[model samples]
Target chain A: EAEVAQSPRYKITEKSQAVAFWCDPISGHATLYWYRQILGQGPELLVQFQDESVVDDSQLPKDRFSAERLKGVDSTLKIQPAELGDSAMYLCASSSRLSYNEQFFGPGTRLTVL
Target chain B: SQQGEEDPQALSIQEGENATMNCSYKTSINNLQWYRQNSGRGLVHLILIRSNEREKHSGRLRVTLDTSKKSSSLLITASRAADTASYFCATVSDRGSTLGRLYFGRGTQLTVWP
Candidate 1:
């Protein structure tokens, strides 16, 4: 079975530093999602993309967080001046359609900010 | 303000026993989904119950949805040690600007001891 791919399975960084995570969705998936999961809490959506255009990013902290899916196949999420509260598991998911029918998630990139 | 909230934050069961988790949501949803996550890993999709559907089953997992009550339940029958994980309930609203967006709950931690 094809799976979503994520890089930097673990990231440790100091507060106020910049960090980025990468994700590659399944080959034919057209919708990609970025989520942040805090300890003991379910994941929250940070951004959603349809092809190369962003469909929703209402919860994303626009001032510090940014995500882009340039070619629509892979995506990158960057945080400038990371904060201690930003430490969490970054998850990426993909689906054949834009709906939340059945999403396939990656192994995730665990970010720890000190 | 969370759309979905799961009950019994933690549960413990012996191998070969059954486990049940309940989820309640605050809004009308188009579909509800159940996901499982192992420690320090990403989530895996389990079962999805549509708003119009009352019950769904996949292998040993059974999911039931009550749109009138806005609640859902997941039952894992004849569970094994490998079934131990955090289970989350996610919903996609039928009415919203981000129609396809998913709202996830805090999840229930289940431990199945062999």
Candidate 2:
């Protein structure tokens, strides 16, 4: 089975710095999602993309965070001037359609803002 | 808050025993899904149950949804050491949104001893 792919399994950066995470959804998957998971808590949606357009980014912090899927195949999420609370597991997931569906996930990128 | 809540934050059992985790959500949902994550890794899709469905089974995993109660349960039977992981319940709401999203619960951590 084809799975989503993410880069930089682990990242350690100091506060006030910049960092980015990347994700490539499964082939032919129409929907892609980015989530943030804090320790001992459930994952939280950061953004959602359909094809090459962003469908939802209500949860994304516009002041310091931005995400784009220009071609709709791969995406990049960036955070500038990171804060201590920004340390968490960044996850990428993909699904076939908008209807009731199961999502495929990647290994994730662990971001630690020191 | 669109987040869901999961019961039994933690559980421990011997190998071959059955583990059960329950999830409750506040809003109407199109479907409910179960996922597993090992430590800091990304989520792994387990099973999905549609709102119209009562129960569904896959291998040793069984999922049941009660729309009336706004609750769902996941059962892992004949568990093994590899089954020791954090289980989360996610829901896709019936309402329309900018982008389709899945809201996850806090999750239940299960430890299966051999």
Candidate 3:
């Protein structure tokens, strides 16, 4: 079975540095999502995209975070001037449709900010 | 912020015993899903129950949903040490436009001792 792919399995950065995470959803999956999981907490949705268009980004910090899926195939999430609290596991997931469809998740990129 | 809330923040059981977890959400939803994650890893989708359905099963996993009560439950039978992980419940709201967006709950940690 095909799975979602993510890059930079682990990353360490200075508090003021920039960092980026990449994800490639399963082929033909039209819905992609970005989530942040704090230690011991549930994953929180950061953004959602549908066919290269952003559907929801209310929880994303626009001033410091930006995500794009230019061709709707692969996506990149960038954070400028990372904060200590920004350290967490960033997970990317994809689904074929909105309703009862199951989502496949990538082995997240663990970010550690010093 | 319309996320599901899981009960019994933590659970411990011996192998061969059954484990049960419950989840409650604040709003109407199109479907509810359950996922499992080992420490510091990505989520693995387990099962999904639609709002119009009452119960569904897959292998050793059983899920029950009550739309009127806005709650869901997951039962894992014949648990094993490998079943030790954090389980989360996520919901997709009825608002069709937010197709790819999922609101996840603070997961329940399950430890099945051998």
Candidate 4:
């Protein structure tokens, strides 16, 4: 079965450094999302893309965080000058073009900032 | 803002018993879905129930949705130790726009002891 793929299963970096995570959604999926999960808390949306165009990024910290899906199939999320609070699990998910369709998620990248 | 909330933040059950988790949401939704996540792994879609449907079943899992109450419940019968994980509920709004955006709840953590 096809599954969403992500890289850098674990990342450790110091504060003020830069870090990036990559995600490749299942083939033919039209919607992609990025979420962050703090320990003991539910995942929170960071950004969403629909076929290379950002549909919602209201919660993204624009000054230090950015995400892109140039070709609409794969995506990259970057954090410049990462902070201690940036230590969390980053998750990527994708879904087909159907209202209320189920989303498939990839194994997340756990980032630890020291 | 997150649209879904789940009750019983944590639960512990014995293997072979049944486990139930409840979730409530605050908006008109086209569908409600349940997902399972092992620690440090990605979420796995378990079931989805449409606004027009009241209940759905897949294997040992049964899900119920009440649109009028904006609530849903997931029941896992004959639970096993492998079922120990975090379960979340997500809601997709009926608004035609934002078609792929899903608001998730703070998941319920279930531990099935063998």
Stretches of model 4 off by over 4 angstroms after superposition? A98-100
- What DockQ does each candidate score versus the true complex, computed on alpha carbons? 0.82, 0.73, 0.74, 0.71
The CAPRI quality class of candidate 3 comes to: medium
TM-score of 4: 0.95
- For residues A58-110, could you state the per-residue lDDT of candidate 4 as single tens digits? 88999999999999989999999999999999999998886328889999999
List candidate 3 stretches off by more than 4 Å. Answer: A98-100
Candidate 3: tens digits of C-alpha lDDT, residues B30-87: 8899999998889999998888999999999999999988999999999999999999
Task: Look at candidate 3 and give me any clashing residue pairs.
Answer: none
Sort by TM-score, top down from the best: 1, 2, 3, 4
State the lDDT at A9 in candidate 1.
100
Residue B89 local lDDT, model 2: 92
Prediction 2 TM-score vs. true: 0.96
lDDT: worst 10-residue window of model 1 chain B: B93-102
Q: Could you list the CA RMSD of all candidates, in the order they appear? A: 1.2, 1.3, 1.4, 1.4
lDDT of 2 by residue, B7-83 (tens): 99999999999999999999999888899999889899899898999999999999999999999999999999999
TM-score of every candidate's chain A: 0.97, 0.96, 0.96, 0.97
User: A8-111, model 2: which lDDT tens digit per residue?
Assistant: 99999999999999999988898889999999999999998888888888899999999999988999999998999999999999988754277788999999
How far does residue A78 in candidate 2 sit from its true spot (Å)?
Answer: 0.1
- List runs of model 1 lying over 4 Å from the truth: A98-100
Q: Where does model 4 sit among the CAPRI classes?
A: medium
Ranking by DockQ: 1, 3, 2, 4
Q: Which digits, one per residue and each the tens of the lDDT, describe model 4 over residues B21-100?
A: 99999888888889899999999999989899999999999999988888899999999999999998988888874666
Retained true contacts (fraction), each candidate: 0.89, 0.84, 0.82, 0.71
Worst 10 residues of 3 chain A by lDDT: A95-104
